[model samples]
Target chain A: MEIVRIIVLALAGLLGGVFGGMGMGGGTILIPLLTIFGGVPQHAAQAVNLVSFVPMAAGAIILHIRNKLIRFKGALYIIIPAALSSAGASLLAGLTEADVLKRAFGGFMILLALYSFWSEFFSQKARKAKLPAHDAPTV
Target chain B: MNGIAKKIILLACGLVIGFINGFFGGGGGLITVPVLERVAGLKTKSAHATAILIILPITVASAVIYIIAGKFDFGYGLPAGLGVIAGGVLGAAALSKLSNKLIRVAFAAIMLAAGIKLLFF
Candidate 1:
């Protein structure tokens, strides 16, 4: 059973990596896997997820770089301020009760999800409609 | 939008993203990807890839804080770290092969699940 737990943890990481590599944060998936199945404590699960992200992000970035997928222009606009706020926020998180923050974030995610679905389908339909049906597939 | 407005949005969004990443201990990408697409004018695949870059420093900064706080455990972190690294490489490579539409739908589904889980669980 201990072996099973370790394997589960690794498998969770694997799935997390795939998701993270795809540019989605793996922590959402990884933290739960560690907590629910791996029996990792909430704090520890978070720690593991954050720490694991270093290598995972590094690897994914390398591949993304090769593909020219990482848009570096104006990145500093986000990164500089974000890094500062995140550091401060992480420290504040350590000191505060997170339930309120967590709830608010949950609402944000739901909104984002709805937007993604709507935009994807609507835009695809619009794009399709704009093109003549007889146009050869531009490869 | 224009230069100043875009900068403002990016900075504002980054601040929010950082707060989410820090408070929740991860998942900044959920917001980062969309912010890049809508506010920053990044294409779909580029937004996904760029989100990681944007989060890396934030992750590292918070990770250092976690380590300093004695929150990290090598025992469990090692195996999972290895797995994640391998999987990340695979996923990055696979991104180019997958269609943008498929990626969008997949991301949406995960976002929904993640939202419910965060709210209820």
Candidate 2:
């Protein structure tokens, strides 16, 4: 059983790396697999899921930085408040009603999924409409 | 059934999967829970605890790398972290009362949509 879990972890890591490189939230995959296939409880699964984000994010961050994919200026605007607020939120989560959180979480994921789809659709359309680099005016 | 096996399994899973999570962001919590519950024979609570333990280290380590490179955004991370931490505790408390299966199904449906979005739109 332990061995099986080890194998699952390894496989999950690989999937995470590939998906993360693409900028997808590998957590989507990780959390579900852990809960359903691995039999971990939801809350514990979430906590453990948070723990695993560090290393996985590091590699992707490096590549994105090198490729100039990261927007630091924008990140600064978002990260500070987000960090402070998230901590507060976590504490509040400790205190708040459970059912509300569950529904909210579920809704959040659904919205993200929809947004991702919408963004992709627009991006594709824009790409199709795009002109050659030299022909297109600079922004 | 035993302590050593559980710890060992957890550790190994954390190391390899954590690395993947560090690298890709795919496996961590999603994979950890099921492995802990089914393979390690832990209850839902125990599995959740195990998952959190794994994530704490992995997230910190990855964040450190970004920090060293001067790319780490305290702003983004902090807010997100704050939200997550607050959300996490709430989620944690809710874990016992709510149906994880329902959450799983919802998540899966969302993921499917996300995946399709990735593929087509």
Candidate 3:
């Protein structure tokens, strides 16, 4: 039984890591699996996801650096503020209502997904057709 | 934009991304990549790479806070982290073979599915 549980968690981690290495956040998949399938509480699940993310992200970051993919100068501009804000926000999250946070996160995810799909597919097609998209920035 | 102005904007963007990452556990890349490309003038590949680097520190900071606050559970997190490390290596290697369009599509699909699951169930 213990081995089975370990295998399940490991598999989930592998799935999350694959996505994380692809520049997608691992916690997106990890958190849900932990909470729903592993029977971990929501807050604890999120915490575990965040904790696991560090090493997974570190592994990916090293690879990206070795590949000369990272833009250090540009990254520096973002990192300081990001680190500071993340510390502040995380503390706030610990205090906020869990249900409210979960719902808000869900809404945010849906909106982000729709926007990403539109930008990747519809906007790209418009660009190929030489038509201007109102808000889509060609990246 | 001037160099200083651009730096400021990037910093502000970072603040927003970090806050979201802290509030949620993941999903920072969804915003990071676009901002890097559209606002910072990075190419798509560069944006993706830079986003990972950008996320590393923010995630570390948030993780630390979660740990200090007694939110983290190492029993499960440790095994999962180890697995993720292995998977990260494989995924990075696969990047050379996989097309960017395919990755984008897969990412979108996953995000959509996750979103629906969270919202409805």
What is the descending TM-score order?
Answer: 3, 1, 2
Model 3 DockQ vs. reference: 0.56
Local accuracy of candidate 1 as per-residue lDDT tens digits, B1-83: 56787788888888988887876688788788767766766766788788889888999998898788777898789878888
DockQ for every prediction shown: 0.51, 0.04, 0.56
Q: How do these models rank on lDDT, best leading?
A: 3, 1, 2
C-alpha RMSD values across all candidates: 5.4, 19.7, 4.0
Q: Compared with the true structure, what per-residue lDDT tens digits does model 2 show for residues A1-139?
A: 7667545544544443333333234566554454445544334444444544654444445544565433232122222332333343444444444344334444444555564455444555764574422211111
Stretches of candidate 1 above 4 Å error? A97-112, A121-139, B96-118
Clashes of each: 0, 54, 0
Interface RMSD of each: 5.7, 18.5, 4.1
Calculate candidate 2's fnat: 0.04
What's the best-to-worst order under DockQ? 3, 1, 2
